[model samples]
Target: MHGWLTTPPGPGPHPVVLIIHGGPFAQVTVAVSDETQVLVDAGYAVLACNPRGSAGYGQAHGRVIRRRLGTVDRSDVLDFLAGALADAPKLDAGRLGLMGGSYGGFLAAWLTAHDQRFTAAIVERAFLDPETFLGTSDVGDFFVEEYLGPSRALRNAQSPQELVDRVSTPTLLIHSEQDLRCPLSQAERYYFALKRGGVAAELAIFPGEDHELSRGGTPRHRLQRLELILDWWDRYLPVRPAPHART
Candidate 1:
């Protein structure tokens, strides 16, 4: 896996936030990320990695996770974080949080359900249930079968909603009302299951937005998204002050 880590200017340990990019086949480049900047400004060490299924790494790397959504990609992400933490002692592994959108959101939900290490998670505009996603998403007809394979059992096995019974991490689900690519029900059903299972969960549906809300929505909604995201992280995995700071 290839990635980047950005941290606030300091020589002390800092809370870490793992960010997973949307496309299972997309890559995370070294560039100015407004979101990461905000989180860093709020005193976080942000880790963004391009795992096994990401592009710009070659064809084999991209195809390695085909019909294998949660396995290799999951390993790559965890391993990347592990390596990051090991190499950078200044990143506090104990105060870890995760957030992702689209396919990245699927992995975020999948990881929180399987791993108990993260303090909390933000699942935004996720592709959670493969079965339902087939019928609802704009590209579901071929995308589901192409990626998950043409098997009902396989889809369920890889579905976060179906396996949400195992999730314990506090989660915040965010989705747009007009996201045809992922759709709103993706977040709704997962939120419902999280609640029924007694996990700390919250769902926020944007009134007039779509899958691109974070990138292209009106400035007002985008700012609102940033605020809510920081709020969730602050409540769940707050950044501790530098030791010498005065109140």
Candidate 2:
């Protein structure tokens, strides 16, 4: 699960964010961190992971991803991030963020449930429910079978809806209104459930948009989405000034 780490300006005690790369096989590392400049500029240490199942390493690593989404991959995310807290000295361990798009979004939401260490989370176009996703998703119909196996129950177990109750972290879900890959309704379901459970959550749905909101959406809207994520983290994971002021 080793990925890459980007250094930020200034010294110790800066907020840290784990940027998970999506795609059952794609790899986005520290070298691929242009989208994270805003987080770095806002004084946050960014840890980008390619994880166990990400591509570009070899077929051996990438092939294990089939039918192993939440089981092994999720563990890699939580455990690797928890380990990074000890290694990255400049990072403020107490103030943390989890962010990504699509499969990365699923990792963010899954981390919200599996790990309590993250102070805040930003999930974009997340495949919230793999069961429903398989049924409703336009693109998922073709890819879900490959990654999740032929079992619907496996997809259910991989879904955030199956585990959303375990999440209490403040989560911000960003998605497109017309995303056929994951569907905006998936985000809606988690948003409503998180609110119902009294867990802090919000969903930002961009109208007339699709799955590639990250690359194809209006520039202004994407900027707004980025700002919203930073603001969410600041509100929940702000750094403590001193030992006594930390309360």
Candidate 3:
């Protein structure tokens, strides 16, 4: 796994946000997003990584998660995060949060359920129920069989919905109303489940948008999305006051 860690200047220890890139086969590079700078400016340390299934790490590494999906890829991310925290003294491990879209959102939901370390999560344009996604999404069936095999039980097991009962992380679900790729129902299922289970959760559905809402949605909506994310983090992992400057 490869990644970059960025921390704000003049910080003793800062709350950290793990930014996971979408695309089960894509890689997260330093040039990929300005969101890292956004988080840094907001007084948080950011760690972004390209785990095993990500591209640019040889074909074998990228294909390793094929037909295995949630299991191996999740482990790779968690392991990478552990190593990153160990190496970065400025990151506050206890005040950790996560944000990701699409496939990254799937991982975020899974992590929220399986790992209690995260204090907050932003699951954007996520795929929650594999069976439903396989039926409703544009490319669902193909990717489902390609990543999770043809077994019904296996697909259900890997679905985030299966573990919804266990999730306790304060979560925000952002989805586009017109998205056919992951669909708004994906967010709906998880959001409803979280609320029913007494978990802290919020849902934001953007009008006239699709799966690309984060990347290419309307300017106003995109700004609103960023504000929502920042607000969630501030509420859960509020930044501590910087040390007072000497006179």
Better of 1 and 2 by lDDT: 1
TM-score for model 3?
0.95
**Candidate number that wins on TM-score, 2 or 3:** 3
* Candidate 1 TM-score over all chains jointly: 0.96
Question: Whose TM-score is higher: candidate 1's or candidate 2's?
Answer: 1
From the highest lDDT down, the ranking of the candidates is: 1, 3, 2
Could you say which candidate leads in lDDT? Answer: 1
Report the C-alpha lDDT of model 3 over 38-138, residue by residue, as the tens digit. 88999999888888889898899989988777788888788888998898788888889998999999999999989899989999999788888889999
TM-score of each candidate? Answer: 0.96, 0.91, 0.95
Give the winner by TM-score: 1
Better of 1 and 3 by TM-score: 1
Q: Report the poorest 10 consecutive residues by lDDT, candidate 1.
A: 238-247
Model 2 C-alpha lDDT per residue in residues 1-247, reported as the tens digit of each score: 6766676776777878888877868987545455678777777788887777898889988878677776677777767777877787877777778888888888788778887887788889988887777779987677778887778787776778888889998888898998988888889998999999999888888888888877778888777777787788778766444356554
lDDT of 2 at 16: 81
Candidate 3 residues lying further than 4 Å off, grouped into runs, are: 241-247
Clashing pairs in 3: none
Query: Candidate 2, which ten residues in sequence have the lowest lDDT sum?
Result: 238-247
